[model samples]
Target: MGQESLQAFQHQVGDVLLRHRSFLDVSSKYQESNGRVNRAITKAVTECGCLRIEAGCQPFEEAIALSEMKNRFDTHLTGHLCDHCLDTVKEELGKNLFYMTALCNLLDIKVEEVIEKESKKLSTLGIFNLR
Candidate 1:
């Protein structure tokens, strides 16, 4: 994405995070330890490109993006993930797919093309079998 589009996406993600903060906070309090939640948030933010380095320090945008993605993933996928189970993982993956599809639609991106490209990337990473 171009820089302007990327910034808009980040802002929209931030808004989504803000809208769901209360729910996320309450859910996280009961569902997992703070450390795990933090780790998950960090991972999601980094993966989403919400986190960026500026003068060797992270900015407010990164923090907001991290919080948003963390809440989104936790709310949607956390309970579905398990170390030894593929069924739950598959369900969660489906949820993620639906979410990204919706996001692409909202952003006016081509959902099918993006999904095809992202599916290839995920398949290459061996994260999941999209086939």
Candidate 2:
């Protein structure tokens, strides 16, 4: 799509989301054009509070559970365009952010710093398997 057209489309999506901003704190609300955080946001919506995450699940485990649930939701949504209900977007998004932000705060790490470090490591390893 043309840049202007894309911008307009994004604006409309934002408008739709803004209309119901209170219902869910979805990824679309916080994501830039980049797809990374958007994935997290979509995940938050799909997770809908029952991430099957045990209380004992570590951060990595929690992240994985959230991602898996998100992938399932993507598959299901792709097959159909059913309307959204009480999807745990808010809870999942809140928790996803809370855990990582908290971890970073405790570790004295900025997200940018972490990303840069990992990017360098991946470059050194000559791998880009960032799934």
Candidate 3:
């Protein structure tokens, strides 16, 4: 299902990608989409007051197994996105994904293939897959 969705999205992007067919245009739009996503999140926190970020250092202990680290990690996010913020964030993220798919289309890369390759790496490396 995921692979099919990615392929469909790629095809859709290719069909409508008239202005940004060139690598330079698509890449620039992709970068801009990334910034827009960040701005959307920032607005949710700063302007909407729907979410808060209390980021800090993550506590780690050598005695704990690497597998346990996942349970101990702190996202540092407080509260949830209200309806308005949620919709805005979702729209921005959709744009980001569209551009990402556009990039993949330009490079002849399959989004699902990349996802599967990363999934395999994570499974193979398990707890050792840092970042």
Best by TM-score: 3
Error of 1 at 99 (Å): 0.7
Instruction: Show where candidate 3 strays beyond 4 Å.
Output: none
Which has the higher lDDT value, candidate number 1 or candidate number 2?
A: 1
Which should have the higher TM-score, number 1 or number 3? Answer: 3
lDDT of 2 by residue, 16-77 (tens): 43332432244333333234445544554455432222234323344555435534332223
- List the lowest-lDDT window of 10 residues for candidate 2: 74-83
> Where does model 2 exceed 4 Å of error?
1-91, 128-131
* Tens digits of per-residue lDDT for model 1, 75-131: 222332233344433544544443453455445566446656876887786523322
Q: Model 1 TM-score?
A: 0.27
Whole-model lDDT values for every prediction = 0.45, 0.43, 0.91
Question: What TM-score do all the candidates reach, one by one?
Answer: 0.27, 0.30, 0.94
Cα lDDT tens digits for candidate 3, 1-131: 67788888889988998977899988999899999999999999999889999999999899998888899998888999999999998999989998998899989999889889999999999889889
Better of 2 and 3 by TM-score: 3
